[model samples]
Structure formats: C-alpha cells, structure tokens
Target: RESNNAMQMVEGLGEDDDLLRVAQELPEPSDLLESDDDAPIIRLINAVLTSAVKENASDIHIEPYENRLVIRFRVDGVLKEVLQSRRAVAPLVVSRIKVMSKLDIAEKRLPQDGRISLRVAGRAVDVRVSTMPSGHGERVVLRLLDKHAGRLDLSHLGMDARTQATMDALIHKPHGIILVTGPTGSGKTTTLYAALERINDNTRNIMTVEDPIEYYIDGIGQSQVNTKVEMTFARGLRAILRQDPDVVMVGEIRDLETAEIAVQASLTGHLVLSTLHTNTAVGAVTRLRDMGVEPFLLSSSLIGVLAQRLVRLLDPATKEAYRASDYECSVLGVDPADPPTLYRVPDGLSAGEGYRGRTGIYELVPIDDSIRTMIHDGAGEHELERYARTLSPSIRDDGLRKVLAGDTTLEEVLRVTRGD
Candidate 1:
C-alpha cells in the first residue's frame, strides 16, 4: 500500500528533462512547510527520485550550502550534479525526506538513518536514507536499490570465464566459506548475491543475515540485524545455523564472534558466503586472523576469496584503438617490445570523462592445500600474497586484462587499482 501511494505521489511529476522545472515550481519555503497539503514538496521530491531511478543512479546526494542547495546523483560510481535549488528550500526538502523515511524531522542535530520503500512508475525501489548535521544545514544521502533490477547471476557479473567457473564451483560446495573482499562500494554485495543466485535451487535451504537486507530473493530466507533489540550478525547467524540452513550469508564479519560463528557454520556442513573490508583476496585471510579467528579454523573453513573493484568502461563510440606505450606496457606488466593495442576514451566525449558504465575487475583465489598450510602456519599478508600471486591474478592484473580487452581504459584501471 505504501508503495502504491508512493507511485501515485510521483504521478504527473516531470521526468528527466522537466525535473528542474518542477522543482522551480515549488512553493515558497515557509509556505511549503506551513501548508496542510504537502503536494508541492511531495511532487518535487518524487520527481527527483524518479529521475534518479530512471538514470540508474546508485546514490543521490542532497547537500545544502549557505547560498544554494545542490542535489547530485552518483551514476556508475561517479557523482554528477543533477539539480540545484534555493538554500531557503533546503529545510523543506530535508523534512519531506525525513517524513517519507519515517525519521524524526525535529531531530536535525543528530545523524539518523532510515529506509524508504517506494514504487516509482512501477519500479520497486528500496532507498536507504541517511541524514547528517552539517555547518550550513542537514545534508541527506539516499542509496537507491532498485529491487526490480532483475535476477542476480554470476554470468552477468563481468567475471572472466575461468573466474566465474571457479566461483561457481566454490559456491556449490556442500561446506566451506567463500569470501568476497573489497573496499566499500566495490560491488561485493552484488557479487555475493550473484553467487547465491547461481547456487540457489530447490532441495537446499539458503539463508542470509544482513545488517539491512538490500535485495530480496525468492526461496531464500533473509533476516535483518536489529541492533535496537540486540540482534546482530553473530546472533542472527547463530539462529540461522539452528534452522538447518544448507547455505548461510553473513553480511560481513566485523568481529571475532561473527567470524568464529561463520567459520563454525562452514565447518559444520554449511556453504557460507560473506564479505570483508580488505583491499585484496589474501588480505581477507590476514584480516580474519587479525579478528581472532584461529588460523587452523580459517584454513579448514575457507575455500576462496575474490577481491574486486569497479572500473568505468570506456564509451565504445568514442574510444579509439591505439598501441600501448612502453611505459603503459611496463605498468601493465606486458612486454614493452610488443605492446598490445588497447582502447582509450578520446577527449571529445562526456566532457572528456568518456565513460558510460562500470564493470568489476576481480582477483579470485581458490584455497588449495599449499595455501591452506600457509594459512594454518599463521602466514602474514605479504607471505600469503606472495604465494597467492602464483595461484591467481592480482586485482590490478585483472584490471589490466580488462584494459587490454577494451572493456576499460588504462587510466580507469589505474584510478581504481592504484594502490595495488
């Protein structure tokens, strides 16, 4: 019913081209808040959200300054200014968002987090709303998760054939933990979901314990962590194990307790999936050991780790094929004498940004007996990484592969995997 109401509220609001015009038509700031009917403000907010969804934006930023209000949309992992409004109207806009997300409008001094489920033009969207106090005013960010983005599949996750096959085999195991490691906003959750989807079928029970369930899939049990009631990843994961789940997904392994529980679950005949906030696949093992998961238990339960990063794809229409320079070849580890022809974004497109979409470049390492021995012996990150390098490509290598394949540019690859 709320979704329907949200859909109805956005009805008749201008779309991409007319969103600014609709915002311009908003009533006076004071009048917007004082009016009994919130139709004007509602329409303006609805239009902004609708346009964002239509644009496939991952996040929406509503920032207020002393002189003006700036609304930006994060598209393909890059922020672009979408709309601007008068500074006087910022409060009304922020207040409306709070009301829709069911947050306290009066509580602007403290940061607040809320979720808003809406259906915009028949598209189901789950928005994670966060508000923070700023010098000028309250700033808002909305993470738009389009529930109808369709089925998650490994084949669609931009993994190479060998990596996808390895992932498929890892997730299909009857027991063991498959970890996807990456920094925040690097498509770790999406990759996990795709792995789950790949293995999801009748005759096996799949369950998840997430901080907040981002996407809902049929035939899978997903539980949200409610810290207000002391329900957390560890608690929820323990409960899930009691339910006789064949597969378990913990949103993240934040502490030793959750890591131990996940390790136990994986060892006790459950295929476990989870993520870690590490920059590389080998770093995940080190992070787990640092979190107090015994090296022996990690060795026995860990099956593989996939480290990934999002790199913007060059605009095919504007990209020109060119031979890589010797410096580029050296950076990419390609033989300098015979550099490969690579594609690059020319200066004429999208104001030289020259990127239209993003794809994940991944480093997948499947744990074998040798690597397991190293893990059991309390190997450090450097030692494990040195050995893991022989087993799989590094994240930068994968990014370089994508660059050579013309899926992305060297500059973009370097931009995302600079540290590696």
Candidate 2:
C-alpha cells in the first residue's frame, strides 16, 4: 500500500519540473515504508561514499544524462566508471547532495560548489563538491580528501636512490629554487609535500600558495589562489615575501610575472619550491626562459629540477605477473637473457592488469656548473635529456632495478611507464 502511494505520488509529478517541490514534500519513511524508491536518497549517497572509501578512491564524478546518471571514481590517478542510475532517480540523488551542501536547488544552468564532511570507521573525511552545466544535465565532481591517509615517504615514491638523495640535498639548501616538472596528475604535489615535510621545522616558516589548497599540513602555512578577487600567485608571493618566510611553495609557475617573482625570490635568499607543466626537468629551464625570464636569472636562481612520470604497480597476490618488455629492456639496455631482476613475483609473467596504482619515474638533475653553463647557452630538451641520462639512469632502468630488487612489481612499473 505504501509502495503504491509513493509510486502514485511520483506519477502525479511532471517530468523534471518542480523537482524541488516534490523533494521538499517527500513522504516520511513510515508513510511509505514499502516503497524502496521512496526511501531517503541520502541513504544512497551515503552508500556511494562508503563504497568509494572502500576502494581507496580520491575522487567521484557524477554525470547526468537525459535517461541516466553515470558515476565514476578516480583511484590511483585512474578514472573508472562504476555505476549508473535511472534518470528518474538522478534528480533526487543530486538534490540530496545539493541540500547537504546548502546549494540553490533551482539553479541548474550555473556552476555550484560546496563541501561536506563525514565520519566513517572513526575517521573524518572531507569531500569537495563541484557541479557544472552539461548538455543533457548537470555534471558533478567530488574530490575526497582523506586527512587520515597521512604523508608518503620519498623512498616509497618510486624515485631511484640517487635521485632521492639529489632531491634531499636540494631541499637542504639554505636558499635556491627547486622546480618539479611534469604534466598534471604526475604526483608533483605529493613529491613537493614530501620535500616540505623533510624541511619542516618549528623555527622555520614554510608557506604555500595553491589554487584549491589540496591537502592540509601541520606546522605549515598554505594559501589559496583567488584570482577572482585578485589573490593570484604573483600577488600571493609578494605578500608571502613580506612575511619573512624561510621557504615558499608556489603551486605553479604559469605566467611570466609569477615565474619572475619565484626566480627573484630564490635569488634573494629564499628557498622556493614550485611546479611547472613541462615534459622534462631540463625543459623547465627552457620554458622559464621562454616565459621572458633571462637565462642568467634562471642559471642563478634555479638549483634543481625533478621531472617525473607515474607507472602502475602489479598486484603481488596474483599468480600471473608482468615482465618488462623487450622495448623496455632495450630502453634500459637490459638483456632479457641475462635477467638480473630487482623486484619480482613468485608466480610470474602475464599481460598487464588494465591498470594499477601509479609510481613515480624521476629524472632529477642538479644545477651544477656544467648544467648551469648549458642552461645559460640556451640548451634544448635533448641537452637536458642527454645530461640527465649521463648523470642518472633512465626512468626505466631505475624502475627495472627496483623491480629486480623486489621494491615494486615489474607489472606495476610497466603499467605506468608502458614498458614491455
């Protein structure tokens, strides 16, 4: 009887019209006890959160269409579409989230943003929500920020020992700029956070200027970039410099002004750390120079560059594992006949696992005299790549060495690096 009534109520409502009204007037659970569809939509949202946490997902995206809602989760830097809900149910689900976030229900054409917190298994989790207009309907993205996940160690980041040591040395410098270069989702932020953690001291002042301020750190000051109101990286850096900070972290070096400011800060007795969207570490210098910063300024201000890429890790529990391909072996000049494995599995040898967790493959180059001279002379990416190759092993070699050493799986390395 209750199920019949709720279905009748839904039928009485017009399609996609006055959704808020119907949502506001939803019958109590007791009044519609038998209607599963009439059950509070909050329960379904909570279920999604629970499942996402269980899968260790970092983000959730909900895309609504004329007939359905597609839900995706970003886990370990990979986006996977997991579920879909009927169009009749999507609005209720979206409305519940909007209500929880205290957003305007009637506003569908414009973007809306909000956040919510929840406790699961005695751990507090922060979920950042963003909704934007789409052709069929609104698309929603939620970034799950788990504070309890804690920080990661440098060694665990898949960087070779030599590169790790180089980074360690760079961070210990009293003053200079250390720029991490990579495409987005290359774990640059995590690497910077680890470096910051290493230098964090009670007596020192470490500040950061980020767009959305992804994660929170103890004993460090982080500022969000608000371009709408004029709190950009350049302005933020100016203010941060006036505060007598020992170390400064800029989220990105986008414009020439911000790059100039960061370089200037590094030249003037401040240890600056920031990221650039370049393919390689050496490319960072060239890109900065192209951004109107003089070569001399770069040669003087820049101290080190760490370029990285993410590789996938194979599951140790699986019997059929992965092996480095001939192409990969060729890249590292490793002979398959004389296999000197670093990390391996007992069962061994299978095709890729579609995808796996990501590991960093780094090319860290310290700005020594030779490198400085090369940069001053307008060196290209090849120069940097050649120099980096000479100073350190290729990313493949380091990852294969780690695989042979049993630090990480061969499949995992190949997964991200797309090796053999």
Q: Whose lDDT is greatest here?
A: 1
The runs of at least 3 residues in candidate 1 whose Cα sits more than 4 Å from the true structure, single-residue gaps closed, are 11-17, 30-34, 149-151, 350-353
TM-score of each: 0.95, 0.83
Best by TM-score: 1
Candidate 2 lDDT over residue span 287-383, tens digit each: 8888999988888889988877776665556434346667656644679776454434443443333335567878787889888888888888787
Q: What CA root-mean-square deviation does each model show from the true structure?
A: 1.9, 8.1
Q: List per-prediction Cα lDDT, in the order shown.
A: 0.88, 0.74
How many Å off is the CA of 139 in candidate 2?
0.8
Lowest-scoring 10 consecutive residues by lDDT in candidate 2?
1-10
Against the true structure, candidate 2 has what lDDT? 0.74
RMSD of 1: 1.9
Provide the lDDT at 353 for model 2. 38
- Range of the 10 consecutive residues with the lowest summed lDDT in candidate 1: 8-17
TM-score of 1: 0.95
In model 2, which regions exceed 4 Å deviation?
A: 1-39, 319-329, 339-356, 403-420
How many clashes show up in model 2?
15
